[model samples]
Target: MSAGTAFLGSAGVLLIVTLIKLWALRKNPNDPILRAVCGTLFIGALLFVTAAPPHLAKINNWFGTPNIAAPIVYCILTAFDAVNIVLLIHWRGNDDAARTRRQTRLCLTAYVAVMAAIVLLFTMGDAPVERLRDLDTYYANTPFIREMIVLYLAAHTVAAVTMTVLCWRWSRQVPGSLRLGLLTIAAGSSSAFLYDLLKYTAIVARWSGANLDWLSTHAAFSLAGVSALLVAAGFLIPPLGQGASSRWGMFQQFQRLKPLWLEIQSEIPRTCPKPMSWWRSMDLRLMQRERDIHDAVLRLGPYFDASTGKRVYAEALAEHAERRRARGEADASVIAGAVIAKATARPAVSPEDRWMLTSTEDPEDLVRMSDALARSPRVQAIRRWAALVGSRG
Candidate 1:
């Protein structure tokens, strides 16, 4: 029913969600950014729950005094925040060599110092109140305690704002998906900063003789927990979703292209004009290049559909074959007067045409050549090869 109890309940829910996200990230540590973000959130939520009223109450009941968990929780939360700061700095340095590791380390150290100062301020004041049970009486009598609360809230507000700004600036240089994730985290952290600001404003107003009630204070705490939850969710979801889609799409594309590659290999040999040995080297090279192209296509498979990729790949094969055939024809003309051509050329081979010079025995090689020629609209339209060499010839 009290403000602190409501915050504890929200913290408990957030703790569970953070744990679930952390488990997922543990299974997939390939994404370093996601892993770091989730790990920080998990630790942060745990620290918050440890410091919240219900858990603090259990600790207090055991020792009959104020629990040290509050300061200890603050320390753990500060450590995680420092870790996040260092992680971002490292990420920035990945793209910009100018960002030295020492600089990042110093930045993290500075953050820790500031957090320590804030915790010290909180500790020196009122014995960290757990719930709003005696808040009205406590505030009326302990004016200095209320001022310390305001100062503590103010310090956190400043730190949160500074962190949000740094994150926003750093996120700009990241890639698309990661940029979104970083910005989401920044936005969530900013919401927490805003909640801190509002809480401090409420404290200041109360000190100034305003009548802000328990409901308003609890509402601010609830919003802060929600903001932290949002940050955790942002860190966990986007990368996992994109990774799943990318893997599935790639698998489907490879499945489709496997058959098409086999078909092309089977068909090339049956349609070429030369003896299989004459063009064997060229044919094998073409097949090898096609295989390379297929592998590259597989690498890019996640980005495009299989049919489109196949069509593109087939076009490349046809072009390579055409170039090889042109080169072969030129070579044949040069060797037209050679004894080998005279001995091997069919009687039907004309002096002006040299298709027999390109004849091959490998049926598979000829079939592949035929498939390439058949697929080429330019070759089909010209009918140049057909006119130059008959099937019987």
Candidate 2:
């Protein structure tokens, strides 16, 4: 891809990622991890925007100084390196607050030093010629400009290596989307390190009187652009993937509860409005269904009997059903009996006469009970027995 296209594409991706992170962070504005990641992404986008050849020339002209964009780019890169390290340290997460603070301070100190040195060297150096795309090679032999270039490149190169090693290592320890994101970050960091290496090799070759400016002017730029896209994508995947996964799971849970929900609504009358398209968040639907199920459970509480559960459980085991499935079957029978008793208008048992299974009546256990209620023939038989007795009552 062309350098302008590469730079622009990377910048656009970063800006989009940054906006997403910012939106997510608003719920907890004090989150260090989100803040760090957000800052790094924004800075990276800025770096790419400023480093593009046309932008570099425009910036130099804007300031009315020859090669002035060089120092600005270097300072921004140095800042990007510093912020990235701070993010890594935060991402790793140390338990010791003091140690984390100390480490963060040290990284910031080094970053400020690098930024100051870049500005100082640029001021001291005289590069009157305007060399936008090939400034590194063009000024490779200049006194102070040489130091400024080396400083930023060295900092960025070190950050790249650190990012590659840490992210790759951490990826092994994690699972799911986080692991994938970390791996992508490692790839991007590796590309960045390669770009920096090319720049270094090209500059050093100039000192030896060889022409290898294409390494910096072409190959390095392309690699840097590729790195930007990879890193932005790495940051994006984890949150987006996790959000999608959670929504899918919630959708499944909502569907699972439907049979039981329909069973309750069929016998008992409650006015529930159909959810509109905008009201169709899976989580909201799941929560509302859980509330309805729990309400039904409470109304049918008096119909549950302790002895019936034991008898049903014993019968299930006698049939050689697996332990968990047998328990689910037993629970299903008790719930089924309650539904029958309520429908048949059986008189309520006293509070002291009521009994429930050991299982907490949470949504998870309810799902299991509902699954069994929908499928188990044994539960049907047990409920038939209860219905006969309930008919007598």
Candidate 3:
């Protein structure tokens, strides 16, 4: 795809994601940080959309001035930058504190001043050529326009540098996906600084009669676009990405226990009230399977011989010598397998003695036990022990 198409596509996706998050945030309107973050992202995407070559003329027409879209875009972008820092401050847990409130107020005041300066400067400048895509480059030699470009770029550079430092420091304190997300944001913020530096240097070079238009008009904008995309992903990855990962983990765990669930369901079909359907939610199906497995185990409680567990534990201890030695989980699996085998044999047991098999209540132990029953030498040995013990009786 062309550069314009790629930039537009990325901006479109970011807009959609921001809108969706904004919609969700509606339920909790009291959250200032959430609103600020979402607003910053949405406005950043809007800046890209409005500043694209195809829409630049329409924007200028909407504002009723030659190349007037530049100031408006810069104003939104400046606000976006300020809001990013405000978000970082709030995320640092000083929300209700006086210091945080003061800092936030200062950021807003600075943003307003920047926006006012941009508007005032742009209003006084004369852009007779009315360039859409390269207004800053076109007016680089103009007096008021030069100052206006410098002002906006300076504001952008400060925000980028501040965010990079804040995110870099905060990244080390966070854990899991959030740490990665912060690192990603810091990298993107650093890119934004590079973008502003390039643009500012190119504009300054123009004052000396140098033709560095390609740096400001092409390279800088490309870096800005890349920074926007990476920053958007970083903001989204902590919550949405982690949520997706958790769902995938649940699905994987459910699939792993399918063999044991099916085996229990085959013997006691009534344990599950109905067959699984595609219409059921994955979590709901997993819940039902867990409930069915527990119920099946309970129905076989009378057959759960405690002596069988004792005998298997002894054999496993002899083989491993130490419970904390290698293959600790193998020892656990052997014990659980013995329980399964004894339950299958239907031996007599007192109600109090049946509690000995309660280890299956733990989800971890259940998975290990289920896996052993599905495919393990320990389970095979337990089955052989059951047969031999049954014959001797």
How many residue pairs collide in each prediction? 24, 0, 0
Q: Model 2 over residues 1-393: C-alpha lDDT tens digits?
A: 766677877788788979988898898799988898898899889988998888888998899999999899888877877877798798788999899989999989988998999999999999999998899999999999998999999988888898899998999899999899889988998998999999999999999999999999889977876786677667667877899999988888888877777766643436655433535777887877777766667667787866667787888888976776667677778778777777888876666656665433566767777787788887778778878976787
Candidate lDDT values, in order: 0.51, 0.82, 0.74
Which lDDT tens digits does candidate 1 get at residues 1-393?
Answer: 854565566566656766776677778867655566666666666655665556667766766646345445545656655656655655555665555557666766775775666567555656655543324323533544455445445545655676688769868777666677678778877887877766655655666787554534465656656666656655655565567666655444433333334433423333343223433444454444345433432332222222322333345446666544443322222222121222334333333332232212333333333343435444342334333443335
Segments in model 1 whose C-alpha atoms lie over 4 Å from true places? 1-35, 67-73, 94-100, 118-123, 126-152, 167-175, 261-393
Roughly what TM-score does model 2 have, to 2 decimal places? 0.90
TM-score of model 1 relative to the true fold? 0.55
Candidate whose TM-score is highest: 2
For each candidate, give its TM-score against the true structure. Answer: 0.55, 0.90, 0.81
Question: Where's the lowest-lDDT run of ten residues in candidate 3?
Answer: 324-333
CA lDDT of 143 in candidate 2?
Answer: 98
> Which residue segments of model 3 deviate by more than 4 Å?
1-4, 23-37, 90-105, 124-128, 141-143, 171-176, 267-281, 317-348, 385-393
Rank order (by TM-score, best first)? 2, 3, 1
Q: Is candidate 2 or candidate 3 better by lDDT?
A: 2
RMSD of each: 12.3, 2.7, 4.0
Q: Rank all candidate structures by their lDDT, best first, as comma-separated numbers.
A: 2, 3, 1
